[model samples]
Target chain A: MTRGSVVAAGTGLVLGLLALGPALAPGFTLAYDMVFVPHPVFDRETFGLAGMLPRHVPSDAVVTTLAQVAPADLVQKTILLAILVIACASAAALVPSERLTARLAGGVVYAWNPFVAERLLLGQWALLLGYAALPWVVRAAARGEPRRLVLALVPAAIGGFAAMAVSGLVVLVIGLHRPRPAGRSVGVGRSGVKRLPWSLGALLVMSLPWLVPSVARFSGVPADPAGVAAFAARADTPFGALGSLLLLGGGWNAETVPPGYGAAVTAVPWLCVVLLALVAYACRGRAAGTGGLGVAALAGLVLASLGAVMPGLLRWAIGLWPGFAVLRDGQQYVAPLAVVVAVGAGLVVDRVAGRRPELAALALLVPVALLPGLAWGAGGRLAAVRYPADWSRARAVVTAEPGDVLVLPWEAYRTYAWNGGRRVLDPLPRLLPGRVILNDAVRVGTGGRRDLRMAVEDPRARALDPLVRSGAPLTGALRARGVRYVAVDAPEEFAAWAGRLPGAERVVAGPDLVLYRIPGATRSRETPISQWPIAIAWFTTFAALVWSIRLPVGSLFALSSKEP
Target chain B: MRIAVAMLAGIVLALLTSFGVVRVITTSQQDPVVKPLYNYGTR
Candidate 1:
């Protein structure tokens, strides 16, 4: 079968499998931070584009654009499915073989691995999008076609900065390994030098959206070491880390593991490790690209190991540059390894099929039978729900109040009856129309050393622990900080506590939500440094996106005319 | 021309399938009001 036909089939299969659970039982899967509560994306007081620029510019932009036209739940589901299809099809495209079975095997292994499943369970869709685009980035870089390079950045850009970083690494690896010119010395050669700048330039330009903001926020705060270690890939031990890399199963939170998962599943990744070793050995001198991919896979595993084998190294590195905190969740590095393993699996399947075609059908069952729980929505964690109507009523009240609002219970995750009993990021931010000050404290250390206070990163979210606990007078100190309305979605005692505070009047009291208005409070304005970066980043992103799109379209037209 | 066309076509197909999947999944169940009884801070 043709490469395109194979890719199409693979994409269809992935979408079918991914959509099966969501289709059977859908609302909005309230897993992790993927709160599907619908709210205006461009709301200046809430998710204004400017506010989201530095961290999640691309993802927020896409969601904001989609939210403008479609329901938030649909927008999320569509993006999720798109990530799966893109991941599968791109992996299939990377396989050197023309055989449909090999491509299909590669696509399945790449798109539906433990990494994707765990990330899905964790609701890190943006990271998954980046993971999905890695193979395409490698394919584009290897071809060294200008048009392919430009087009490749589109997906990488959509995946956001993390995806671009991964893609950039792949490009760098490929560029370094570019076969030295026929007669040139053993060094990187002239052609390699020329390609390096171009590839790096594309990555830089495409990543400007997040790059600008990341630079601005680089020295703003220090990351917590314990927080970083909590998210580290702690697979039992160093050997377990390697096994987890093979299984793509080193998520920091054990809750992210699908229900009913057992030790037997370890055999699937073990089988993959053996097959990959065989493929690497067989393709050593014959196929340079496969060898390079194998090397990249090994590098990914080592990186994923993080401090597991060499604890002091990662801690030392983190001390030098806190920004490396992003890499703290070493499990994410396993994404590229997954691509290599999938492709390797495909190569092994192709070899076996070449000698005995019928046996290739059995190879397909390996990944399927192993990750049975992932196929059924991470053991039903992907179930969906609707937000409560009271949220809307509270939003309306806050929208009219004209001051920054504070959500009570002062926590990040909540198990709302509105979301079918699943734990989700507090829906208050989405439910409120005005600027919100949520208590996003980073709980670090343990027992005596444990520090649970509002994150220093955003000073706007005032540490309300004292005020809430003491039921202090709301007029003098709290209102001076610009907190106009305090909305508590907790039990009656909490609402009653807030109500008794001096100058706090109960507004919109309901069974689920209670709002207390501080009449004299004012809205706090964001500082210029915080606001300017977003504006500049947005401007750069818009300009880059326009240029990237126009150049490719113009090139396509020119190529079409030349072909005829 | 073929590469660009194929890439665009694939993206369009992915988007369409996404829309279809979302529609089917969302429509399958009644949208219930989410009101959590407990505050489970970030875990």
Candidate 2:
């Protein structure tokens, strides 16, 4: 890497750490599923990996292993910081410029944009990891070197399927740039066709871990209409959509917008668009790479406008396969566009700095000045908190009495005081381990729909709901299904239900959480599925990773042999 | 060959340095008593 790229990356890393500030002190942002709960990675029964694929498995495994050596919270924080650095470094590498100031400015914008800030607040670390690796994938594809291609897959493997998707898109864009041969008509498309095998092989190898499981257990569970709407891009006007994409600011949830944001914030996006246009005009035909990135940015914007522009089409495609739900949050498509804008802004900076060196400092300061709220956890939207001591004590109590525990007021998301007022996945299942049942309902939907009912159709979880609501006594029917302990976190909602547990002994009673032991509850029989697919996926991922490493090293040996 | 070696080495270095920096920063800082910005139940 050039010195300019190194400086840009270094500056971005320092700023990112500073931006996180006090949040990093906790070592964990207990905002969402990123709760500091450590567990074995391969528990298919508890995780329910039989019917679906979790793209975060590789990252989860890494964090789980890291927890053995360090505090899980610390490990989580480290991962977040690493992601930010990678994002900045990758963007810096993409800037085809010699100017240090311009490169630094680009890295800052790419790493600390509104899109990244919103996703971070939402606690989508896995997605962010994938987003961070995008520029590297683009860089590798542009070069089309075998060693570079292998290097690109490293991040794709670690980031999982989402990164693989982005990498695939980038590779396709690079392939489009393949020029026609000088004179031969037959060889016109031959080179591009020949390169197809390598490109496809790389994508398949990188995505094998997630792809194998998804294909093997292809549950065509369609997303709910409300979920699709809730996550859809909310840019009503054409200019508004373009501005939002440029600013990286089109999150569906209004709450995700910085607390004190006003009209001034809207101007920032427009300014970014204007700057990018001016840069494109100035550098027209001068930079071939910029043209490809511009095309990518335009494509990303169109994809992001899917539901917003044509709701019926988006919904229709989603109905064809549940996998299309990945596009539900079309706003995430802004990631590549953000990279393009960052690089364009850097080129603009480079041009201006060449004429007036004094203006370089001003260019570097533009990103910070424009998006100040994003710097400090999007105005506390991404604040970190330490889980209460009682949570750990409750986990121990549940662990001592070994049986399947059912969390009361059973819901997927919970707002915990311990998690800094952030709504997060109920940590009980991960904390206590062993078939801990919780409601996995998709409540965000219109009145009645089959697709929306998929997650909520858990008979076991659904059976407990009415019984708890009626404050009915726990009978043998409920006990046989393996709900041994009733863990109630929100007492106000379920106190009456807890009062109805017949012959139940209070294990760990606290203000925030209470655990009740069922007297006659027994362990439910578990039917284990064939583990061959999981084994194959894991084995293939490991082998591919090893082979990727060897490919580059082995090339050096080949070079030496040729020299001798 | 040298460029390829440097690229690989740089990746490893970046990964290690990031890990080390985060660990050191988080561990060295005093743990702050963070209060919930708003009531958790209201959300």
Candidate 3:
């Protein structure tokens, strides 16, 4: 069989696995959501509730008991299906031989890995799809095809944006239009950049709506120099550089990373290293133009995937490169790396299938390298650093009863309310009056050595509001505000850590979370899931799916047109 | 080449619309304090 057929079939199976895997798995949101499931944002569905109120704001949104089991958003799941379906049809219908195999190999392996799926799970679909369409983008740029590129735009906007809510940063990257000349339309020459004006102009018009806000906010908002900081401090991957790349097993302790949730030795990482190495090697062989670009594109993905966590080059990196941001708690930035790992893996698969005819069967091993990395989601069970649920013991405890204000050091509640249309109290109220915006690893305005040390070591201290001190005092404040319940998700020794306080007592204890209640507060009725962006989110999903399919199809068309 | 730039710009636009348009539409009349989360079905 020709290598082309092998690429097509192999990609088909891989994408089929990605598209079909979650459908068969037990119903669960991705691990990122699992971490954020308990926030009031997840459970309550009230419109204008979270918006109008402060972080301490209680959720007033309504809830629907039944959830749409199909899929949640426009990122991975939808994109995966869209890719498999589109690539298969395109390859079978028009793209014959090397083109079929090579592009097919590119789509499935690069686009459908577990790491990539995680980004989709976290709502980074726009970035994923935008990046997935990169090959096409570069191809179109090289060919000077306006009609096809215009056709590709509709899907780009629809699918990419549906990937998220606070999707500003990724938008910045996507908006970048590399200028190429109109004069050099069909060939490689210095004056080829003239065509750039039209493309940039069109890009500007499409981008204005988003750019306006970002530009407006850019000056006022604090520059998230976190990535820069990590690099500068030379602490980018201080936890152990190469180890994290392959670490599939544990977290703080010997917490066993659940299977397929970012384990100790996922095959994807090594493959990425090898692919990167090959690209570097290939760079020496090829000059400027497409050859340089293939290298450049791979390099961009490598940097993006490495983000801030690549380690060692932190300080030098921060000084020289302005691309990364240091994230609070730092590690959550893993999302980008996962995408890079997947994309890099895809490049490896595509390169192998396209360049080497003999290794078609060996090409299927990419997924084998990826599944083990999903172990991180299990969090080594070490991630169970929150409350333990137990109802038998009776002290004043705060549980997430309906109408109760949830104040915990986790984000689980927010996901439920945000995704499901629910309300949750803010865990951090810095300048706000609500319960919490997001808890854990949040910044404390006042800081010093002592403060830093205490913040790092004391789980109870870390969980407690500096303003309120501990659960007991926190309960007093809540009572003063007519609040009924107080949620605590600190470590098990929280009571011991706070050195024992008055007023609040534990009523319910679970391995994951705890709830507390004030004695005489009135229980206000919960507003139905009013805050839901019901029509909007669904439309987004529909739009994104439509686009993901359009992409590979358009690419196929463009490829066919290039045929002799 | 111009088309590719336009396409990149389009992807960029789509990325913006995916997030920005939603933000604009949802935030237009709402209080600045509240965050309008668009749960664009899980991708």
Candidate 4:
């Protein structure tokens, strides 16, 4: 294809995606349950508790208690905004002359990036919108305009601090690739400070959050050295050891690693390696061109590439992150790769452009030409649904009574578990003024397996279902602690437990769960954040489908593409 | 002329962005954490 033809095609593709994403993401979410739904962003439990329940955060932990308001449910909203930010950033990438080629290349690479697709679809807009600022910063660096750097970084300071940190690395690599001052020395320059990208300061700010908060979170709590050792042992696989550059392209994030910083770095090559090779061949005629620059960034990116996957280094880089003491897993380091991909994209495409005739057009068209970007978006939306146990079934069973306590077990007693509105007996009861919650760890035997150790046999610590035997101590604890509701995972022994109490009465039972009220215990309603509404929604939707009632086909909903 | 054009464009973009930002804050009234997620002292 002619250079201009490719450019036009790419731009057209971006425009097309810009329009389609908003409508498609939610639709896909409804259809083939996305993988992320169960796994969730941030705290999956919080998503269920706040969004499905009373739409609020409970004053439970020091972290949640510290919030003036619950952390903003930014996912669905983030997806909606991703469209706007992508469009705006795409426009920014098509900037002034002289640097127009690099900007076009950056835009082209960004449009097709899977990591960017993740941001667009997964509701990680806080991180995505942050990457949108990269192009302007690049343009400013290309022009050596300090004012532009300041202007570009101000938004990062307010909106995308983490994106700034991860993507900032890309800007540095690109700046190094820039045509420097004619007489510039190795380190020192006109003013004496190293000539670093001004955007780097803002990026430093972004990484600070990941680093600072993590450090503070762990500083007070000493590492379970055994836990860290187990994590290290688990890193035997390529996915575990974190050696692959491609793995970094997954959008790094974890309790242990920083976010998307690595994906941005690695993704640039996936889009450009072939094109870079083509450009290197295309540049056979050029005097001094981007082929060499591409090679340098490519090589540097590859060396740093392993850093994307080998998050073990991230364990050491803990010095740079928030929790210097406690090192988490590979997931957290994805941010660096994301930033790398974003900025590296600009350079890789720039290399391709520098060597080709009318190269700008090709770079512009690159992302649009890659059909996978669309599929990537769909894949992410469907990811949110992969897990089924996202919403706490136990939480949903309770009727919204303030002081009413129900006993439910968390251990693996697979069948008929999570009967409505039942709290487990020991720990929960221990917190109450007169209630005693029967806990496997405390009253019953610890360990997920069943064994009756508490009552000469707590029925936990050995059997497949620990809570099955927990019924005895649970009933006894419910009596002694004056608990009213026994929210057990509805099973055969529940009747036997209830029978032992003189005044026990059955209060509630669902298809899977059952609740019993003890005698002389005060009556109390269930919790508001209980899973009732979700249950109702499921039942209502199922019933409607059985009768073939028309389901709402919303335009605004996001959809996933099966083809991609 | 370029300065004026940039200024006008900036203002328009700012207004549009403000509208977008407002749309976000208005609709996303939810929490991102699970409750009793960790019974730390007890566990």
Candidate 5:
């Protein structure tokens, strides 16, 4: 590797260690959507055979496969650290400068910014993996080499459909700006064929693991329109919604903002940095070969701000086609803008060094200085914590029977006192051996106001909701639906919930968890959706990735033969 | 005149950045603690 490459990678590794802090320690870091168990079951749900939307489809499968080789805690740590290193290295490589300081400036800014901070705090590491893949994707697409593009897309493919969608958006925008040389007009033809070859088809094939299952069940599921309002971008700084987005700080969740991020004193300086980066990009971007990236960044910023600017339009679009619901979490599209800002920061340093070279050192330190909370695991908010002993007993008991397990409080997310009171998606589904069911309807809003956006994707969960709410004896109902075990993680609701299971046997009861075994609960006669299509889809994606790996190796072999 | 102006600008920039850094350190330590029965979709 070049000296610049080594420095950029080292910068990423250092920043990653700084950001992860105590999370890099022994235990699993359980935050929001991030859940890693000791042994994740590769069940029907892992392959999206269960009735709910397959949001975790191939990502869960990939982790489960990896956990087979290494401990899940180690796997999670490696993946999270790799995300930072790869993101910083790839973005630094994209700067059209040979100077090490210029590359360092780009890498530092890209890997350490508000967008990365908020996403990491929110525990959306899979999406962050795709964010890391983006600069590589742009580089590969600019070369118009199919193999390199496909190889660059491996991380997004493993990250599932949302990551693929975000990657596809930037690729589509960048593809639109490909130059037409010699007046041959390498743009869109009259016949409607894209001059930019292979990208669209490759994206589609890579997306099949999540796409096939989602499309198969698309008509059956209608996206909750309330989600548009719930997930719309909100300001995290003194700058209103649009201004916050331009600074890459308007993620929907207020709770996810870095410590002291919203205060005027801090926010003002961060805003200055953002404005300077934009000015630099506007002045020097085209000359530095970042014209296409600039356009993509602008397009991304516009999309990122759309929900905040026009929620009604977004709601209307989702109503027309549920597929448009992908646009609900607009803050995710700010990824390209983050890249633009980083490259712009690099340009600023490169230019300033021409005169007043000492000032370049300060510029190199500015991004980190402006946002110090991102260091040390977002102020120790993301420390690692082990699962409780009761949880393990509950998993073991449920797995011994190998029947369907239902999680109650009837809530999708839970907070264990042991896990530092942080809210995390229940690990029960992956921890146990069966089709573990939980509530899919997410509750939004704070304080007295509550909005339950009904996303009843799992048919079984939908069937049991009324029974669960009635607080009546559910022995007959559970038996009829073939729910062999009910895992209760709520301590407050323990007595009341356990009382409702009158005829069930208390298999394992603890303060943190209570598992009841319903005797005579036979497997439901309902036939499962055929797993053939999902399996075939996964196989094809894997096969294509394996085929794509050969191109680089073959090229190296050819080069060696010519040299001899 | 130009050197004095540059010095003044540098002092102000440094002061603001120092203030921002202090704020970031203070805020990073503060946890936006969620309630036991908190809304699943929010913080």
Candidate 6:
């Protein structure tokens, strides 16, 4: 490896260690959307054949596959650490300059920023995984090699729809505008015409794991129009939505902002850093071969800002086609903007280092300095914790019976006392052996007058909504719906609803989870959605990834490595 | 003149570092006090 490569890796390692300080301990880090169970079962849902839209399709499958080799906790920690390390190394490699300081500037800002902090805290590790792959995707697209582009997209593909969508946009924008060789014609030959289609085709093939199921089970997985307003980008900084997005800080969730991030004292300096990078990029980004990436970044920023600036248009689009609902959580599209800022920061440091080495050094430290809350596991909000033994027992009981398990309290997210009260999506859906049905509606906003309750996405969940809300006896209704087992994770909720279950048998009385069995409910067959298409997609992606594995693993990522 | 210039830069760097360190230390102590329901995150 080159000296610059080593330094870049070392920077990432240090930053990752600092950021994930407490989370790297013994157990799983159970934050919202980042639920890693001890042993994730590969059910029909793992392939997105379970009726719902399969948002977590192949990622869950990949984790389950990895768990077969290593403990899921270890796999989770490794993936999280790898996100930082790969992101840092990739961004460093993308810098146009050879100087270590310039590379460090890019590496640090790319790996350590408001976008990374907010997304990590929100527990969108899969999305961040795609973010990590984006710089490599940019590099591979520029090279116009089909195999390299496919290989670069593997991480994003594993990240599922949102990640693939973001990466696909970058690929499309960058691939369409390949730089012309000095004397070659601008729109002529194989370079200009054919390569973009190949890139798009690669993206489509990689996306098939989720895409096939989404296409197959279109009616079952509904995207709530209300989600556009609920998941819209909101201002986190004192600066309004546009400025917050410009600084990469306008995630919809206020709780996910790094500690003291929005305060003027720190935010002002961070804004200055972002603005400086933008200025630098404007002066010389195209010359540095970041052709069309600036446009991609701007487009991303505009998309992200639209949720805040123009929610009605987004809602209208989602109404027209449920697929457009992906635009709801617009902050995620800022992945490319984060890359642009990182590259721009590198340019700034590269340009000034000869005359002002101290300033260049300061630029390297500025991202970490301004966004200090990202360190030590987002101010210790994310700590490792173990699931209780009772959860396993409940899973065992439910698994032995191979039937539909319904998770209740009628809410998707939970805060278990065992999990240090950190809110997380119910793990029973993945932990249990059979089809587990849980609420998919997300309630947002502070519970004042204007609290927004999102429409339920799953048809099963939607069917249960009125039954649950009516507070009538649920045993007969649930049995009619073919629910064989009801797993209640919350204690108070179990107390309120347990009495209403007339003919049900209390199976496992939990320290953390409660499982009850409905005596004579007919078993619900798996959703008619076939797994063959998703399986084929997975196999094709796996084959392509295996086919692309020509370089030594280490050399594949090394900046100095040659294309073989 | 060069020595003076170097000393001035050193002071500025030290000052920035100190400011950052202090902010990080202070901010780290304030644990997230959001409501449990809002843990799903608020808009």
Question: Candidate 4 residues A334-437, lDDT tens each?
Answer: 43333334344444444555566255444444443332333322322222111123123433333244224444554311222221111122222212222223
Instruction: State which docking tier applies to candidate 6.
Output: incorrect
Question: Residue by residue across B1-43, what tens digits does model 4's lDDT show?
Answer: 3423443353344334433433343245322221222121110
Question: Residue A459, candidate 2: how far off, in angstroms?
Answer: 7.3
lDDT on C-alpha atoms for all candidate structures: 0.59, 0.59, 0.33, 0.34, 0.76, 0.79
Q: What residue runs in model 3 are displaced by over 4 Å at the alpha carbon?
A: A1-23, A33-99, A112-130, A136-404, A410-437, A440-464, A468-472, A480-484, A489-514, A517-564, B1-43
Task: Give per-residue lDDT, candidate 5, residue A550.
Answer: 81
Candidate 1 vs 4: which has more DockQ: 1
Can you write out model 6's per-residue Cα lDDT over A255-304, one digit (the tens) per residue?
78887688899889889888988888787665455466887888898889
Between candidates 3 and 6, name the one with more favorable lDDT.
6
Against the native complex, each candidate's DockQ, computed on alpha carbons, is: 0.09, 0.05, 0.02, 0.02, 0.18, 0.21
Error of 1 at A24 (Å): 6.7
Model 6 interface Cα RMSD in Å: 5.3
Q: Supply candidate 1's per-residue lDDT for A391.
A: 68
lDDT (tens digit, per residue) of candidate 1 on A1-564: 344544544564554355336523555677665655675555542223222224455666677677889887788777777777777777766555555566666777777666777777767777777787677666556545444565666766776766676666677766555553452222232355566677777777777767766676556655555545556675531346666665677776555664434355455465555467346534531232422444556666777777456656777777777776666667777776777777677777667767765556455545544555565465346776665666677778777766777777656666665555556666676557656766655332222443333243444553555665575556666687777887777654464556455668778677677777887877665553455656676676567656656544322111000000
Candidate 3 on A1-564: residue-level lDDT in tens? 334434454545444443344332332222232221222233221222221111111111111111123222222333444544443333232221233433443344444444344443333334344444433433343334433333443334333222111122222232232324432223232122543443344333333323332332232232333323222111112234334432211121111122333433444464455456345334321211222233333333334335335544543553443222322222222322333333333344445655663353344333433442322221121121221223122122232243345355432223222113311222222211233323333221111221111111112223334544433445455555555655554444346423332466555656534555566666533323332343344344344435445545434333322222
> Could you tell me which residue pairs clash in candidate 2?
A27-A73
Q: Is candidate 2 or candidate 6 better by DockQ?
A: 6
Q: Residue A46 of model 6: what lDDT?
A: 84
Model 2, stretches more than 4 Å misplaced? A38-42, A45-55, A176-191, A220-223, A235-242, A260-262, A265-270, A273-292, A442-475, A551-564, B1-43
Those runs of model 4 whose alpha carbons end farther than 4 Å from true positions after fitting are: A1-84, A87-102, A117-126, A135-216, A222-365, A368-376, A379-564, B1-43
Candidate 2 on A164-269: residue-level lDDT in tens? 6666666666545553345211112225445556666767766766676566545434344545655667642244654565567676644455432324554555
- For every model shown, the clashing-pair count is 11, 1, 119, 105, 1, 0
CA RMSD of all predictions: 7.1, 7.9, 14.1, 16.5, 5.7, 4.1
